[model samples]
Target: MRTHSHPPGHPHDDAHVGHGHSHGHGTDARRLGIALGITATFMVVEVIGGLVSGSLALLSDAGHMASDVAALALSLFAVRLARRPATPERTYGFHRVEILAAFVNAAALLLLTLWILWEAYTRLAEPSEVQGGVTLAVAVAGLVANLVSAAVLHGGQRDSLNVRGAFLHVLGDLLGSVGAIVASLLVLGTGWTVADAAVSALIGLLILRSAWALLLDSLNVLLEGAPRGLDVRAVRTTLGGVPGVRGVHDLHVWAITAGQPVLTAHVEVAGGADSAEVLVRARQVLRERHGLRHVTLQPGAEGQPCEQREDLHT
Candidate 1:
């Protein structure tokens, strides 16, 4: 017999499927708004400063700040969208919007970094005069603004990929500010205009590293890969070890979004075993051992014909 059984009397049920979507997002939205305002205001200033100073480092930092403005705005929109209730046609609601925003932000960062690198390369070939005094003053101001924005977003970043992407952008801008400051100092002290391009290139490399990591993480979620640090083989082994279970197959695990994992499996019970009791124990094991609360299990007798294709077993 095929039994579609869930854990009975479990506190976590379908109602809790999108728990993170509702709670704590208000704080996150507010944080994003604060960071957005700060970043937008400074981005314009940095652009003007870059133009007046003619410092490649300052110009590259301004470019990154521009991308930060966009990233923060997108993150704020995604946070609001994620609050929408699930509809019949869209069972998972708009949670994935956050992941999409993160992906887009990462892509933007990568592109901006590449552009900065190219610009720096050209500057290296034919160095230009940079106003070290103006660059230093503007870069210090930008650094202070970035510090405030980064602090505002840091609290929410660990909980949401959308927020994390914005945080990374702001952090990159912070590094760029530091690079600009260093370049300005080098130029003022030793008349080495090449420091401007060299420092800009270094900042681009740093941003590239962080952007690539965010891109991969968001891509994995979009592709429905298992959550990070979760082992499918370990989950299967645990299920097969459940008392009265003859075998386990058709097991699948994937995240709807970060911190929200879902699993489904087919379990074969020994002949004459109490399927209901076996299911309860299995659910308890999964919940306690593997932190899997959102689960669906199909229980059947040991000799029952496999309803799923053999190739699909994990």
Candidate 2:
């Protein structure tokens, strides 16, 4: 029985360089800063407008924008913290900080949504006299601010879960702004004060949707679940089909962050086959087919005793 274990700094390590390292977050940080400024400025405006206009919708939007400010600020801090050098105690550096921030932002959004719904119910019971003119003007201004903030975050949103959480927050705010506008118009045309509470309820629903999605994604990563697209069964089948491979077992695939995936597996090679070639083929398949660059492959010849049996998990 021939058994081999690959070291972290093996000769083939270059094929999967930058395992846990992320680069070029400086641009993301700057973008987040700009978005943060826009959101904070509008948040103050909306708070004042909500107070003077007595519009529950406007106040709800302001509350969401306040959360957006926190989300963006946390995202920016995460990007900077992720750049710190890796340490012996924390080999993966602070990359997971961004994910943790995302989880926190999602939780905050959920809580805010619940509060908005409760407030909407109370407002519906005893409607307030909202100023249509002031509500309309303020909602329009908020809409513009939210649009700009969304544009600033859209690009980075696809690249990082942290940014995605922040983007979702801003998007929820944009929807809230739209709802506030519609409610204000309805109040102006028909004097239906109930429109304000109705809009706030709808905005809360939208926030709940986005918050649920972000929460699930962040929890999946934190729990070390397989990435969204990659199936563990398919991966094992693919590895088993590799030339000179007898079978595969103890396969694992998971994400370290939003875009980085890591894999580890034990492969059984045909007797007398070149284990080195099998190892290379496995790595290549993982990299090219699964988009997995960070991989650790252990090869064992047919009928060989599995030395890593105790450590292997399905």
Candidate 3:
């Protein structure tokens, strides 16, 4: 879907939401589906393997993978929901479902990381004798699966934050696999059981690092903060340069979904200029120059302030 592309003078409307783009939502869903499948399969194996091998780290990692399965499943459903037409009662067509999904995914990751850290702490306190070879074998399998998952998602990371978030999960898993491998080598060579526990701690830290970023990004989008790539001052500057536009205020920029940006503003213009023409030019500048399609431009007298500010302060 093309973005709002409406120039200055137009008010925010469903048009921006309606006309937004769907940058490869289908491919993204497919890749995530495959990744989730692999993760789920390995999660079961790792759980059983951890239990048999007596490795707390393996068990914790498996638990996190289970959550990943749920995340990917929800993301798949959200993507499909986003594509559906909005009903009479539900305009905006469930696009933000992905945003909600991102939030949940991030929160889940944090919780999972905390749990892993707890497990790591306990393991640190009492490093137990675990079958490092067995844990290593399972981890190797998980690594291959994670690599496959990452490959499937690599193509879409540039398009969707949702997709990028999923990719990060797999990437973390890959690193966890490496940590597991190292622990196994240490145990095999020197019977250092603490190495296994230490590696788990490292894995938890890595997972937590990625999770934090996702949490903030998802929250920002949900809060309707400007999209990550958006520049508020630059947007204001550009709008101010539009002919017939004297100044700008009440400017708002946000995302409806991945790669879809919307803007709304009050533009001070010549008292008698044609509102429509000024709006068209502003819309063109936003869309053609900056990739913002959803635009709302409110016209005002050259020296007047936005009616909103006046109303709010009065």
lDDT of each: 0.87, 0.85, 0.78
Shift of residue 151 alpha carbon in model 3, Å: 1.1
Pairs in steric clash, model 3: 1-21, 3-293, 4-293, 4-294, 5-293, 7-283, 9-297
Please, what are the lDDT tens digits per residue for candidate 1 over residues 1-314? 33344444655455775665577678889999999999889888899999999988888888888888888889999989988988999987888999999999999999999999999999999999999999999999999999999999998888788899999999999999999999999999999999999999999999999999999999999998888888999999999999999998788898777777888888888999987788788888898899987787777788887674121111
lDDT of 1: 0.87
The TM-score that candidate 2 achieves is 0.92
How good is model 3 by TM-score?
A: 0.88
Clashes of each: 0, 0, 7
How much is the lDDT of residue 49 in candidate 2?
Answer: 98
Best of the candidates, lDDT: 1
> In terms of TM-score, which candidate is stronger, 2 or 3?
2
lDDT of 2 at 300: 71
Cα error, candidate 1, residue 188 (Å):
1.2
Model 3 residue 80 CA deviation (Å) reads 1.3
Q: Model 2, residue 117: what's the lDDT?
A: 100
